[model samples]
Target: MAGTLTVWKFDSPTGADTAITTLEDLQKQELITVLDAAVVSWPADKKKPKTHQLNNVTGAGALGGTFWGLLFGILFFIPLIGAAVGAAVGALTGAMTDVGIDNDFIAQVKDKVTPGTSALFVLTTDATIDRVHEEFRGQSAELISTNLSHEQESQLREVFAD
Candidate 1:
């Protein structure tokens, strides 16, 4: 069905929270997707900050914890095939924990978020973009959507496209 899609990019967590609350309130009348996302923030005047590690396995103690859990699981059911199953589980868990820039489009945004420039993206369908924008006009967020002019629609399509 034809519906409106509204996107708002917030500057920080506070702005994101406010937008999320507003969108959720509107959800009583429409559908919304407040995707949970995070980016490194840094001061623009200073040099850019490096990407912080997000690997759950490689990080200190995380892999060890995974292995420890597997060991416990295996020991608890020694007579059964728990050892082999637990080993497989632990290996799969560790392999899945690698944090790589899987999506090129999102990676661009990841690279831009410095030590003080986080962004939160909220997408809502069949909602009034103007109402949402008016509610969050003062905050450091820009509302971009196809609800605007043809040019804006095309721009938004490209930005949100695969």
Candidate 2:
């Protein structure tokens, strides 16, 4: 099955990490399959969030470091560069579009995930949506799907091919 890039934002700094336990449980239950997973935890006192790849669940399908680094860097770092480097910003935008992500999605994530907030970034497939949703009914998480375009899919394949 084709993988979907999805993110879920939680109110607390530890929320995303806490959710990982549940995610592992669900995966074992055969309710969902994960390609790769990572957690972003941002404490109130921190300047920025920290990331950790879930290596145990990540098998052959994993996109690993480069994919997540570029994405999180775009979401959390690029803005600091601002228009001073207009060409770089434009190139960054182009790079994002090459992976089938748009400005709207980037803006949305930037808006929702802030200091004291945590997010779970997941590349997943074969999920029983209803069951998964039911399991997560307790926490308030904003779900965002990248919904990779055909072009994005092709680019991702090329990225993994190397």
Candidate 3:
């Protein structure tokens, strides 16, 4: 099966960063394939979160750029300094709907991952969920949302929407 878009939330940015590292390690071990990953770290001072997307550095090239560019475009309304890139990203965002990610999911992540917290957005396949869960033992991280199912998504929305 194709990978799913998943968001993992942590109480602290450090925790989220650690989780990303662990995910990378898993990928190295051939336990999972990380298509693309992004981390959002909200400063304690309540400034705009710093976002680091791995797609740019991982050779995802244009497709990766378009995905993250469109995402940040939606989250921050980043002025599409260039009309061509902006148009391409906009169209890509629409095309991504078939993959189970949409503006609503992005909006939810933006709204829920508040100041002083962090979130890791991952597109992955061949994940060993049980092993991953075991790896996260004792962590306060929560699986906030995913392209899993409607009932689960609704439950997550209810829990974090407040």
Best model per lDDT = 2
Q: What lDDT is reached at residue 71 by model 2? A: 76
Query: lDDT per prediction?
Result: 0.38, 0.80, 0.66
lDDT of residue 131 for candidate 1: 70
Output the lDDT of residue 20, model 2.
88
Worst 10 residues of 1 by lDDT: 50-59
Task: Estimate candidate 3's alpha-carbon lDDT, on a 0 to 1 scale.
Answer: 0.66
> Candidate 3: misplaced stretches above 4 Å?
55-63, 76-93, 148-162
Model 3 Cα shift for residue 69 (angstroms): 2.2
Candidate 2 structure quality by residue, lDDT tens digits, 96-142? 67776788888888898899999998887788888988877788887
The deviation in Å at residue 107 for candidate 2 is: 0.5
| C-alpha root-mean-square deviation, each candidate | 15.6, 2.4, 8.4
Ranking by TM-score: 2, 3, 1
Candidates 1 and 3 compared by lDDT, better number = 3
lDDT of 3 at 136: 69
lDDT of 1 by residue, 89-145 (tens): 555434322221113423344344434454433322344656756766777776433
Note the residue pairs that clash in candidate 2: none
Ranking by lDDT: 2, 3, 1
